[model samples]
Target: MTVARKRAILTADSVPMLPAHVRLIFNEKRDSWVVLAPEKILWPDDISVLILQNCDGARSIGEIARALSKEFSAPFSEILGDILEFLQDWSDRLLIRLAEQSGGKP
Candidate 1:
């Protein structure tokens, strides 16, 4: 059976949280930074700082997920729903994109 894939749509109005508000605590021993937001965002553990960094309203979810899969050795096929779920949580928290302003239904 073939699974359906959702193509991520990019918009101009999607604004990521600013760097100042998002703080990173690097664990040199671990070689990864622990990103802390003033409040919780969705699935923070599943996403990395780089993934959030590139979500600058230009890259689509598919693009980011693909890159993340390559960089982090994650399965791209399984990450789509997870990405969408993250986007939904971020939307609820007003973190990632202004969904209504973006003009497309997810």
Candidate 2:
């Protein structure tokens, strides 16, 4: 997926996912995981991997942050900024596609 010239403003209701051509793979050769975007390959840190896994085009951004907060043992308010930053960065890189959410989904 290509990053749009006009980016979408992410919100609590936004659901993000990797484009079809983009994927996360365990690169045995590199001894690490990598995000293989159509334009480039990226090596992400552990926290990044967790963020990527959460972007399944289902969970909203708020839900994603809450889950991450639990996993990292941090308060949601404390981690929210960092989570937003990561999502925005990846979205700008076309590693994630954000969808508009109407309401909470089961």
Candidate 3:
């Protein structure tokens, strides 16, 4: 038997909204870190929102893939691979936590 690894993902609609109590914002336009705790809102300039927000606690890889397919109008298989790659990069940076199923599946 092999061990399971957690995967990170987020939905397109929920991407603009951060979790309660958590604050995040980007400031490439001004070169700063804009944070709003207790009132999280996605900045229009924040591209990471699309890549990171799908990382909800229990959403599966397949679920995210379908959602992204509609959102980007791209092929499911391609979007799936792309999202996986994006998540891997974020995981390496410690930006988000990977979802771990009780069993051994992403």
Candidate 4:
């Protein structure tokens, strides 16, 4: 019998990081950023590059959104919503994972 692992649930407080099998790199030949997984490559646009670069496993979703909002002069709410959706999509694709909680709280 096989147990299906549950997918991670993303939230405002979730700290996103690239999984061990995933990497984000600048493809010089393509002159763009690409996400490399075991069997897949994703070419992200400029805005997505900004978001992916900030997923350092240390900042929460809210923190990232706040920084992006300030950098682009966009509204916080809009940025947050976009970030949440973006992260969730990547998380579902197994490219990103939520960092383990530091404290004893789950």
Show model 3 residue runs off by greater than 4 Å: 1-23, 26-47, 101-106
What does candidate 2's lDDT look like per residue over 4-97, in tens digits?
4877677667788877779988999979999887779899998888888888888878999998898879999767778788888887777778
> Which residue ranges in model 4 land beyond 4 Å of their true spot?
101-106
What are the per-residue Cα lDDT tens digits for candidate 3 across 5-103? 544443332222233344555668977445454433434334355545555655665677788789879999888776666655544444444433223
* Clash list (residue pairs), candidate 4: none
Model 2, 71: alpha-carbon shift in Å? 1.6
Clashing pairs in 1: none
Instruction: Quote each prediction's TM-score.
Output: 0.50, 0.83, 0.51, 0.91
State, as a TM-score between 0 and 1, how close model 2 is to the true structure: 0.83
lDDT of 4: 0.87
Worst 10 residues of 4 by lDDT: 97-106
lDDT of 1 by residue, 46-95 (tens): 35456566665456667767777787687887665666566655545545
The whole-model lDDT of each prediction reads 0.55, 0.80, 0.53, 0.87
Instruction: Give the alpha carbon lDDT tens digit for every residue of 4-93 in model 4.
Output: 978778888999888778889999997899999998989999998899998888889999999999999999999999999999999988
Per TM-score, the best of the predicted structures is 4
As a whole number from 0 to 100, the lDDT of residue 82 in candidate 2 is: 80
Output candidate 1 Cα RMSD.
10.2
Question: Best to worst by TM-score, what's the order?
Answer: 4, 2, 3, 1
Candidates, ranked, lDDT: 4, 2, 1, 3
- Candidate scoring better on lDDT of 3 and 4: 4
